[model samples]
Target: MNEQQFSKSMTYAPGLPEGATFYSAHKKRVTSHAVANAVEAALKERGVTIEDIAEIVLDLQKPFMSGLTIETCAENVRGVLAKRELQHAILVGIELDRLAEKKMLSEPLQSLVDQDEGLFGVDETIALGAVSSFGSIAATTFGYLDKVKPKIIGRLDLEKEGKVNTFLDDLIASIAADASSRLAHRVRDEEEKRLSQNNGK
Candidate 1:
């Protein structure tokens, strides 16, 4: 139930079209699974079980955005990650964008920019995983997490191309916090479903 397996060939593509179930479901599965694993691992580290951490993470990681979208989720994910890691993600995304803008681009990373290739979004997925992991924490600094949780797809920076480190971090912190909170909801949902089945049996 916690694991998400998808087609290996579907990580990256040109763009996320408006109505694409595979893309949407795949991204959501990847995101939820990452958050779930993070909660489980964090609780384990603290000598607890998945059920114990569920409520905490859910209270922590609710999405800030009213309606969650990939772009918005990505923004919150980036900020919610952490200081050093957010910086890294911003830098990586910036560099990728910059590389795409360059006069002469290399073949290896070109697909990453052109969006013509399918594997370009791998880095984004990884960065989201990191944020989900740390966002599972329920520290007080989570105010920042609360503040930025609602704008999952909003702009991180006003006029800059890639200065999203500080900007996006704020938003992502909220997303992470909200996502953490959602963990409790998800776990509870799973438990209810299981109990209902057992009762039927």
Candidate 2:
């Protein structure tokens, strides 16, 4: 049925509250899978892929992890992407960038975002807030990438025309940093498990 028909068909549960109504079609239950898909789609629209972030994670983690595979790095990146906190940050930051690209923002804000001015630190702030959940390692790694602008981050930062990636570049860095931190902790856990098994023997 059409949306209006569907909305009309919905009935409120037994309740005494006056003017209370059932959820509408626009308020349909959102699934975790749908949110995850949107986050992935947002990244893809901005020319980023899981592998792109995974490569940075591998660069950050491989030195300390023997025989580390790109597949493992990609897996950890996916794991980080699944967090609601990170997903929220990705959506918000990308939306801002998109708005800026369309010059929808006002005055100094629009100019700052479009130019990605040196004084414009809000982008990094949002990215850092999201990565902070992963602890100090992730936070510091984000700072490094923000400064160095390695690989995809560098490319995004350098794009001047027809795009505004002020927030996206830092968001990508944060994602990679957080994933690397997660992989590090996972490796440490596995090592400890092995050591504990050896001690038990």
Candidate 3:
């Protein structure tokens, strides 16, 4: 189908409930298709692609799921949040946007995000949040990242210093992943409602 048809189809999704427009107008509601689109757009804006993100997330999902004991991850995440990294997060985002404008990530940027280096954890968090779009998981994960990234920066070289274990990173990363998944589900629900309402009109 053409882009116009695709956009129209999205506006009138099946099984949408009443009162869904509030979510859409406020941009709080999201559909899976929308998530897909948002992810694509954000990547393109960065001169990166879905493959780049998918590669990182896929690497994360397995070890991130297995070895990261919940408590440890939470504690590590808490440590990151304690440092006050909101401005830092924004600065990093701007830097990334610049890199996109330049059509490539620097070698430093590549190592940090692609390799998931300890120094660039907050950057990773924001990127995940943006592309995930309107998912509760994304919101909450980004919220957590936004809330505590500076602390993580302050606590860098944690593994080298033996201050952290796999468990800690795992928990924080898991928090992000779970939050995004949940966000996707909620967005879909609200989106269905919005689309149904529009159809009823």
Candidate 4:
């Protein structure tokens, strides 16, 4: 199809108004802030607020970084959520859980997601894949949180009120893990700079 036809056929371009011109629709720029807000809204609708995830981030870094504030943790969490890849992960995982809740997925697959089958590792797989860009520290942190299921992660996993959070719990863990990794590296960079300056002086 020609570019015009292709653009016209696109009815669901993100951050674009309905029936927008082909040029406007195709050329529309999706800002990081918009994606982050959408992801945060999805989490809030699922009863998982930014603050809820930030608490996990705070707990993860507080011991290692003294005087780490919840606001800083929350900012890092927002930074992680703003990433395009991570945003994609959160939307996909949450949509799957939502579909499972509505019994929309096919059998066997439906049962796996709905029951959060222990053998079904795809949930963690997606979560880890999204955060892998952050490096090994983020991946290890994710594994630790997945195993421990701390705070909100633990509560989400235990939910049995017809809520399917198989992927969500892992996704949240990955976000918090990534945020912790970012904070750690940033602090380490600052410390290294300070040490270098002191030595020079």
Candidate 5:
């Protein structure tokens, strides 16, 4: 088919559910802000601020993509926080952790989730899926985060004060990985654009 015809065919019909849309502004704003707030609060509790996350992002990105400043890394993290898919993943993963903590699951499942069995692997799976959008860099970054367990992630790994963060530790790592990947891509795009302009000149 022609490009115009293909484009026309891809448009959604009216009256579709808000969830069916690629980007529901209201849902995106609310969920993204909530998830961002939760992340900030968790980090604050562990004595890690946004500046720390920015520095971590800079560390994660500089080796992969050159000329990336700390300010750009911090802005990219905010960009990741604004993404609808990231928000959804954060909300869902945290909800699952909360459910497990409450022992809401049935029978053997409850015990398995509560104990965070190695064989289960569901928590990592969810986190991996969240980072998949950013490609292979995300996978490596996630491994780095998992290994280092910086700040909030390390805190979340420990069960303290009757709070369980079984899924959250992995989820937070994925978030950082994804944010780093986002920054890398943005930097790459800008570099490409500059190179193209120079070539044209």
Candidate 6:
């Protein structure tokens, strides 16, 4: 069959889109929900409860917007997770953490993961990529969260018997920071909308 005919004959699935050829048609793309699920599972494995995540969400939102509900905080998290680049970063960071925990990396790399080396900044660097989604505030928020290590983050940072959360800790902090930035932007948008309506009236 001709290339054009082959392309025209391709059928795409719900979440998959057809490409110029049939080989690319069945390729599966990662969705935001999948990224969120991976994050949630990692948190759960580390004993982070849903309530703990909710508390972080609330803490991040309360300072920027008054009377914001937990539901809204969750929605912000979902929105932040939906970004494709952010998802890639989270997955990659988490996978590195897992590989480190398993001692699957090279000698120096494995040692850094095992010892939680002070000079090893690679994990933090990976997490930093996610901060740009929400602007400078996200970076500031991440710094704060990293310093304070509140809620489950504190738990992750604390040395445990058999667990290494070096990367997970940073990943979680970035997520919270991103969520906080999202909430702040959304709150500002709503305030602007209200003011616009009042001026119209």
The best candidate in terms of lDDT: 4
Can you tell me which runs of candidate 4 are displaced by over 4 Å?
Answer: 1-31
In terms of TM-score, the best-performing candidate is: 4
For residues 1-201, write the lDDT of model 4, one tens digit per residue.
Answer: 455665534544555553332344445445566667778889999889888988999988889999999999999998888789999999999999999999999999999999989999999999999888899999999999999999999999999989999999999999999999999999999999999999999
Model 4 per-residue lDDT at 119:
93
**TM-score (all chains, Cα) for each model:** 0.30, 0.86, 0.25, 0.88, 0.69, 0.80
What local lDDT score does residue 97 receive in model 4, on the 0 to 100 scale? Answer: 98
Look at candidate 6 and tell me the lDDT of residue 161: 74
Alpha-carbon runs more than 4 Å astray in model 6: 1-36, 49-51
Q: Write the per-residue lDDT of candidate 3 for residues 27-141, one digit (tens) a residue.
A: 3343444433443344355334333323323343435344434344334223332222322333345455445335466777544543445565655555444434325644555
- Candidate 2 per-residue lDDT, tens place, 1-201, comes to 566665532444433232333345544444566678889999999999999999998888877888999999999999999999999999999999999989899999999988889988999889999998999999999889888989899998888778899999999999999999999999999999999999999
Could you tell me which residue pairs clash in candidate 2?
A: none
lDDT winner between 2 and 4, please give it.
Answer: 4
Candidate 2 vs 6: which has more TM-score:
2
Cα lDDT, all candidates: 0.41, 0.87, 0.40, 0.88, 0.71, 0.75
lDDT of 1 by residue, 1-201 (tens): 222565535556434332332345554222333433443343243233323223333333444323334443334333333344444444444445445545245877564444424445454353454455443442333454434433332233222442222223332443355445444344468779999999999
Better of 1 and 5 by TM-score: 5
- Relative to the true structure, candidate 6 reaches a TM of 0.80
The list of candidate 3 runs beyond 4 A from truth reads 1-158
* Deviation from native of the Cα of residue 16 in model 5, angstroms: 20
lDDT of 5 by residue, 1-201 (tens): 444344323444344444434433222222334556765665455444556667778777678776778788778777776666766676776777677778787878777777877787888888888888888998998988977888767867876665667677887788778888887777679889999999999
Q: Per-residue error at 134 for model 3, in Å?
A: 16
| Candidate scoring better on lDDT of 2 and 6 | 2
